[model samples]
Target: MTPSLLEALHWSTMDISGAEYRGKEVPLLVVPTRYLLKLDTTMISYCDMQRVLFEEEKSAYNQAMQQNICDGKIHPLTSIHHTSTYNSLCKLMEYCLSPAVTTLQDRLKENELRLSMLQEEAKQLEADTQNMRNGSPRRLMNHGAGGKSSPTAQSRHPFSNQGSPRSPSGGSRRRAC
Candidate 1:
């Protein structure tokens, strides 16, 4: 039944060999509508082809369907296409994300370093203030007379003291004989 149906196919204008050449006539293989419906009841077949075959002639559905029908085989191409697409998408994602990851790591390290430096500066300022309150400076310069500093030398006002002790009244405290 299948061989007879397939063998009966013929061109309405020309045939399958001349399908590439296009002018006015649509290249179509003419077959009985009953044979095509019985042989190609399912969606994907020679009958379902857009312009390859013509299956809309005389309707003889019930008589043609009574015979044994053999269907065409199909192969899917999605697996090949999807594998390549997955690889490309993965590469694109890595390319887009690399710079942000590097920048985030660098900024975190910089933040830690800056915080430690600020803590060390605070400790130094605390020590300097303690020294000022204790009536001493952080360092003392040596004079020609001696490198040894008197205990009371830095006890006066840091800006006003001239190495002499003066009474609070701004004069000598001794009485005249």
Candidate 2:
């Protein structure tokens, strides 16, 4: 039955070159040739297609309008009055902050003045330290001396007591044998 259908459909051939179908050569007969013309069933009329395109365009336009409305709602500062108010608030903030800036500037000036005074004091202390290092004969005196001595005299008489009383024991005495 399927071979008859294939023969009817012109799909079966009589030329069998292989032994597998040697005894099964189809008889040559007048088979009608059929050509299938492609029919586009999904195509609509031109007017209907244009109507669908118009609907899509309309939906896109509506969506854009809705987006613009939403944007306007999200930022209500789209008006000139709101912009002017925002600028005024900024100016007010600057005005409120000016006093703090002035106070900080005054404090900075005072601190600079104090720093200069302290630097002058430090310079004076350094000068005083240098004078003490260079200016006193008594500053170089030895531990037990009462009078100030020059460097040469102190060097020449290194062990002189300069009027300190001697001990009665004379420091230490050895016994005579």
Candidate 3:
């Protein structure tokens, strides 16, 4: 029996001495609680009784239930309710989650479309950038006379080549009063 059921039945614990058929001593727990003898017989062993009462394998069941909940096969609170209430809650959850699932699917599709559009825009921008890089030198060369002009021809003062030794005034001049 489950521990809750045992608790509800108000069973008390007592250790009783017993002997095996081979004349060996053994210990037994006497639970002074009314139970259907046939149904309770299977749980009479010490280990089985301890397992049921002390909850040593509690995490196993809890982990299984958690996995079921995550897989959407069972509701988290289903164990706490009767079969009828649990069925009703399951139906209610289905009803509530249906629209939420639909909304999520719609949003996913919208995001995919937006992402594809952005990707296409990025590709176009990359192509434009490549074309700009390829054509820039030719454009710069053509900006002056068909790419034939010397570099100094594009300077702000083409006639004032200042690197020569000749000064602009040809000779030093005295200041006049």
Candidate 4:
């Protein structure tokens, strides 16, 4: 019935090979309503064919699974070493996180070192202040000054006893009581 319908639609015989279809004219059945219905029918048939093929494929797959099980094929769970997409994602996350972790560790270490150096400087400052409070004679020297000394120039100099012109007439002159 379908063949006859197709034949009735159009038929043209040509004496020349590779002839342009423009010169040829066959009786074209331009039933707009019927053509639309036919197109819909073809779509429906194609969908049905796809459905049957898919069902057959599912059944064949199930049979193959049963056969594999009977033949002592590797267990699905044990055979697969990795099926978790999460594991790969976690590995990628870790790979991305490692640099940040290392950077944080380095920054922490550097901060600790800076804190230690600051602590040492604070201790030295405290010791210096304590030394100043204790009235240590060397404190003035540390303060960049000549420490508490006598006003006499003769005693302050080592060459005062050598009788130099810069010394007084006496070898040394002591302050009056």
Worst ten in a row by lDDT for model 2:
35-44
**lDDT score, residue 45, model 2?**
43
Q: Which stretches in model 2 have alpha-carbon errors above 4 Å? A: 1-79, 137-177
Between candidates 1 and 4, the one scoring higher on TM-score is 4
Q: Best candidate per TM-score, number?
A: 4
**Model 3 alpha-carbon drift over 4 Å, by segment:** 1-81, 137-177
Q: What is the per-residue lDDT of model 1 for residues 1-177, given as tens digits with 9 covering 90 to 100?
A: 687665666443447667797579778899988766752244234224422322221122222333323353222344344446555655665565566557657877998999997786667557546656765442422221142433334433353234334444578663343
- Model 4 error, position 144 (Å): 5.5
Candidate 2 vs. true structure, TM-score: 0.33
Backbone clashes in model 1, listed as residue pairs? none
The candidate, 2 or 3, that scores higher on TM-score is 2
lDDT by residue (tens digit), candidate 3, 6-92: 875664332223433566779988875565354235424533544454343455446655666655668746655444554565566
Backbone clash total for model 2 is: 0
| lDDT minimum window of 10 residues, candidate 3 | 11-20
Cα RMSD (Å) between model 3 and the true structure?
25.9
Runs in model 4 with CA error above 4 Å? 1-83, 136-138, 141-177
- TM-score, cand. 1 vs. native: 0.29
Q: Backbone collision count in every prediction?
A: 0, 0, 0, 0
| Total colliding residue pairs, candidate 1 | 0
Least well predicted 10-residue stretch by lDDT in candidate 1: 50-59
